[model samples]
Target: MWMNEKIKASEVELTGLNGEDIGIVPTREALAMARKLKVDLVCTSLMSSPPPCRLVAAADAKKEAQAAKAKSSDRVVKVKEIRLTPNIEEHDLDTKKQQAARILQAGNAVMLVVRVQGKEGAAAKVLLEDLVRELKEWGRAKTGIQVSGKQAAVQIDPVA
Candidate 1:
């Protein structure tokens, strides 16, 4: 309700695009007004004893938030998964390792998983350990064991 910004409240206030305060009105009245203006009733302060809510146009409000998030944003780090095996061929392992490294360099986290097949499942622990060690070394630039399980996982953050 940027068009109507006379609302105000100390215990609660109206939040508009870019965290702007439009003003505060009664909960029911504010929401009704927001709906009339085709806006959203968003809570800006949830920790306040009574919490504060804001009336903002859903589309415009979201756009502002997205813009804010994009500004000085960390490259949206996504999880890139790579499956491995203990008896994996050298060439295959190296190829996967390189792929994972590339993902890390691109600013995405990498999740490496080692699956143990029948018969080989007995040695799955040793296999996972070795693979994890290799990946940790190669990904030392940005690496951490995020999860270790029957099907283990390793996370590598951006190199920078």
Candidate 2:
């Protein structure tokens, strides 16, 4: 059956095995060529006027399309967090940084939050900046690290 959209009145456009155009061949001819190539005739791209179709192996076309979908999905973002105190211990900071690194390496954004205790809140930025800088080194270029306002925070997501 012909497509509902208007097309230049002709036999039919068919693409060959190597993706070459074998323009306006009879439908039967196109089918025969597909069988000769041991492939199926597939419509590959949109053509407003002609609605171009291609003759490719059915299995190969499906696999290629699926792979494309998976590749795109892999880029989807995920978020993770890490928390610290303004007066955090040096060793504990190292441990926390390592944990954040692991999260970022696994393809997630890390939000680093620093909580200030008592008088530590006023001087929190000094420590928070240090901690953010150190944690950022773990992610390198793969993750984005941001510090939320007010140093008295208790949350940092790894998948920033």
Candidate number with greatest lDDT: 1
CA lDDT, every model vs. true structure: 0.61, 0.59
- Tens digits of per-residue lDDT, candidate 2, 1-160, equal 1221222333457777676777766555666676787776655444543446567676876786687778877766566656777777888978977877787767676666676555666566666556556655444333333334554432333433
TM-score quality measure for candidate 1: 0.44
Look at candidate 1 and give me any clashing residue pairs: 7-23, 7-24, 8-23, 8-24, 15-54, 40-56
TM-score of each: 0.44, 0.47
lDDT (Cα, 0-100) at 21 in candidate 1: 66
Tens digits of lDDT, candidate 1, 1-160: 2223433333356565467766645666766767787887666555653456766667866886677677858556688888887678878978987897677667677777777555565455565556556656445424543334456455565545
Question: Cα lDDT for residue 33, model 2?
Answer: 71
Clashes of each: 6, 18
